[model samples]
Target: MTQYLAKYFALHRKLVLPGIGFFNTSTQPAQLEFVEKTLHAPVHTINFWQDENVADNNFISFLIKETGLNHYETINKFSQFITGLKEKLQSGVALKIPGLGILTNNENGYSFNPENLQQYFPGITAERVIRQNAQHSVRVGEDEKTSVEMHEMLNKEVVKDRWWIGAIVLAVVGVAAILYYYLSR
Candidate 1:
């Protein structure tokens, strides 16, 4: 299969035909809808697209073009290829065809979807499923200690400023008393 794809790429200078089976890249617009009788905010969705022409062709035609094999031989070859792919899926590795992209198990691991296939095709249903992963907890023991120490230092500076202000007020009162004593003398 690799050799066949390589030959096609070498001849066409592309992995797939431009219009027949090219890759499509587009961003799906965020949509808003009601949820639980309340309006839900819209969120952007990342979408990938690929051509359906590659999958549209029957196995026999592919075999005839690539291997120059007869109809019976082509069917047998395709069957074996599909069986091998299933075995690979059992091992947890997804199969990625060059122009078609990935084929992997869905969130349930029972059904599969082509990663790059477009959702707009007739009779095709593309559903996005969310998967949850393990949560992580962070601890900051030493960092918290340092932050507390910094807070204490700032407090001491504030106290020092208050002391300086008190000393200035005392000096001003002493000057006022001396001025009154001189005037009385």
Candidate 2:
């Protein structure tokens, strides 16, 4: 029963335990830390909301199929289970759902603390690798160009801009040579 509930929540990423609360799983995408040069792994968080109006029709149907029980029997069994949990919660006992989290009745209302998934899903150390001279497609405005082609084009422009400097140096060297020849003669 608990295992089936956990399995259903895992598969659907959402679960509604009637008269209690609803659970939802949200994903935080992996991020790159530029200064640290590390890529952080994505995280999946299970959030519990105390919404009493959440419908459990789909969940009941799922349990019926999984438990191989008729709809009325399944409902009766699940209602009994929920009633037991409610009784314990009202008596100031924290209920821990296996593979889920701890649910406690607080001064404010029902408070839920999610399980730490890091133990089951450990983060791996991922480092960013950048190739300096690698040729890859890049979008330049609306046109696609190879990185090598762009590098060549940029280098050509640099050389073209500095052509006058080389010409001036050569002219100075030629004038010095002419001066030496004329003085020697």
Candidate 3:
């Protein structure tokens, strides 16, 4: 499987790993020249993007063909398998698919650990534009401020409880000492 994937990528410069994602290689145009005296060709660079649809389709087809099952049954089985694998990966476990690559979570997001050299993959490089979740930068309003203030008030109660606990301990020790003196007499 790994050899097949390696070769597929080597030939097509891209391979969509089932249940994982697509590995692509592409080239980028070189930096622009402000004033050119002579006519020269621009340089190009390679890049890659993971195709979720392709991966999902490949996974479904594999289940149907390999198990010789109907579409519904194969889909259910494949869905469960994919869900389990996704859960494992989301829970910080790396799924190493032979010849394909390793799927692991980083601090920022999920990343692929390709077995072959990155150059072989071609246009797989850092993205120029960084996309982020819309919910990540939610605006805090008056209600949110009130909630934060309420939490702060609860924190004060926690400190008050600690003080009361210390006072209770001292009172108990004093009573115990007085009882010990009377009993010893």
Candidate 4:
């Protein structure tokens, strides 16, 4: 169930729980830091909002069609799940959705502290940064500057071509699994 929810969040970008809240994805843009000498990768975070009174629309039909589950049963399952989640939040317990962050209620409403994946890009792993900013300003010929540029470009390619983010990815997945198991129980 949690797996499907994660997948749906990834694919659809928005998921509404019948009486709990809806989850959507927001983008953090890539940035280049000249002073820091680093290029930050863009990433996505889950944004959750509570709206208990909203009507079921195309999402319901989409879920039923996609999962091949009975419409009423699907609704009931989601309803029960949302009810339990609400009860937990009302009880002052934080709910953690895998790949997402902790969901808790406050005086205003529910808030989600999204897990940061800022270091990793989709399908690209963050690699060990090997370049150090030059300590002193030095005059360089056009050919030398071009060579440096090519070296930086090649380094970026190497980082993108490798699958080195496996450990971080697994750790996140593991944490999500633990949270899911703990919550589902």
The candidate maximizing TM-score is: 2
Cα lDDT of model 4 by residue, 20-135, tens digit: 77878888787766666566677677777888876556666766877789989878876787788889999999988876678898999888888776645533334565556543
Window of ten residues with lowest summed lDDT in model 2: 118-127
> Model 2, 127-154: lDDT tens per residue?
6678888889989999999999899887
Which ranges in model 3 have alpha carbons more than 4 Å from their true place? 1-20, 24-59, 117-185
In candidate 1, list every pair of residues with a backbone clash.
none
Q: All predictions: root-mean-square deviation over Cα?
A: 15.8, 5.9, 23.6, 31.6
In candidate 3, what are the lDDT values of residues 18-106, reduced to their tens digit? 45466766544434343542322332222335445665465455546656899999777656766776788889999775545677866
Error of 2 at 100 (Å): 2.0
Judging by TM-score, tell me the better candidate of 1 and 3.
Answer: 3
Worst 10 residues of 3 by lDDT: 37-46
Q: Pick the candidate with the highest lDDT.
A: 2
Worst 10 residues of 1 by lDDT: 38-47
Clash totals, every prediction: 0, 0, 11, 0
**Between prediction 1 and prediction 4, which has the larger lDDT?**
4
Error of 1 at 131 (Å): 58
Q: On lDDT, who's better, 1 or 2?
A: 2
TM-score per candidate: 0.31, 0.66, 0.38, 0.55
**CA lDDT, every model vs. true structure:** 0.50, 0.86, 0.58, 0.73
| Per-residue lDDT of 3 in model 3 | 46
